[model samples]
Target: MATPDFVLDLRAKIGTDPLWLCGVTAVVVKGEQVLMVKRADNGAWTPVTGIVDPGEHPATAAIRETLEEAGIVAQVSRLARVGVTGMVTYDNGDQTQYVDLTWRLEWRSGHPHPADGENTEARWFDARSLPSLSDDMARRVGAALLPHGEAEF
Candidate 1:
């Protein structure tokens, strides 16, 4: 993933100290499959995600990230879930806490591919047979798949 310019500026002042950021995760769905990306940084599979740029709407960021990371144009079908979560320290010592908004998205056009260097692979998985994911990610996806409406926390 390309480090946001804000993150780079912060890192210059604080080195590897933890930073609080806002992000969006897109659960881009087509029929019964969900789009997923295998991250280049750690090879872990997850929904399309990216830091929300300053002043950008979470829904807009979700769609933009889906296109940027997976080569698919999407629209936020619904806001699935929203909450503050995370305090992760990467192997490189960069730490971040992300307040994430996860959205259920509908694919509009284009095939899935790893368009950005951040993702090593991007594909659609049968909703019932998804690959192993971190508990947090599983919960996010599950929230998007819920039979009811949006969730807030």
Candidate 2:
């Protein structure tokens, strides 16, 4: 994934010091299937995820990321989960953490593909038989699968 210009600027100033940022996870559902992406960096199968741009609404970020990363259009159904992630140290040694907003989305249109270089594959999987996901990612999907109501915090 390309680093956002704003983050690059911040990194220039702070080096590897941990920075707090906002992120979004889009768990798009089409009936019993869920959209997923195979990340290029780690080959992890996960729901469409991205950094929320400065000043962008988290729900809108979820929609934008789904289209950009997975070549699928989706509409946010509701906020699913809000949680903070543990610090992440990237390959380049840039350390950061995120307050993630997970959104439950409904498929709108478009075929699934890896539209962006961030992922090597983008496709839908049966929700009951999805590839293994990290515990955190699994939690995001689980939260989204719940009946619509207050977001999990």
Candidate 3:
């Protein structure tokens, strides 16, 4: 896995965890709704995410994952949030700590469906009607909508 953009930047600032350079997540929002995919792996609702591939840009991977998982295309609107957490990586054998870069994506256009291997179900839900989600996904959504954060590419 490669370090997502914001995570790498955050690691520079925080300076301790060598593993801060790790995965990324995306919180895609549309209208008064947000997009969520039921992950095929865990059978749980989560934000669109993937391990950043080597030599690929984080933003590109985020956009790609959004398309592939949720069957929707969106524009990256902001660096909604960055989280420091533990990840049990597939490429590595440890639950080493990670800095997750979560982007807020604005709807562009696309019909919603489960588009790839990662998702089983993909749909938009009313902001108020959001289903039970992982704590990390829920936290990312809250942070993306907060007034204090700036939209960063």
For model 2, the stretches where C-alpha displacement exceeds 4 angstroms are: none
lDDT of 2 by residue, 10-43 (tens): 9999999999999999999999999999999999
User: Taking the tens digit of each residue's C-alpha lDDT, what string does model 3 give over 1-153?
Assistant: 233576556556755434535467877787788888887767888778876766777787789888877788898777877677755454433235656788878889998798866678888888888889768778888877553466432
Candidate 2: give the clashing pairs: none
Residue 2's lDDT within candidate 2 is 85
lDDT (Cα, 0-100) at 46 in candidate 1: 98
User: Least accurate stretch of 10 residues (summed lDDT) in model 1?
Assistant: 144-153
Error of 3 at 50 (Å): 0.9
> Of the candidates shown, which would achieve the greatest lDDT relative to the real structure?
2
TM-score of 2: 0.98
How many angstroms is residue 46 displaced in model 3 relative to the true structure, after the best TM-score fit? 1.0
Model 1: per-residue lDDT, tens digit, 12-112? 99999989999888999998999999999989999998999998888999989999999999878788888677688887899999998999998899999
How many residue pairs clash in all the candidates, one count each?
0, 0, 0
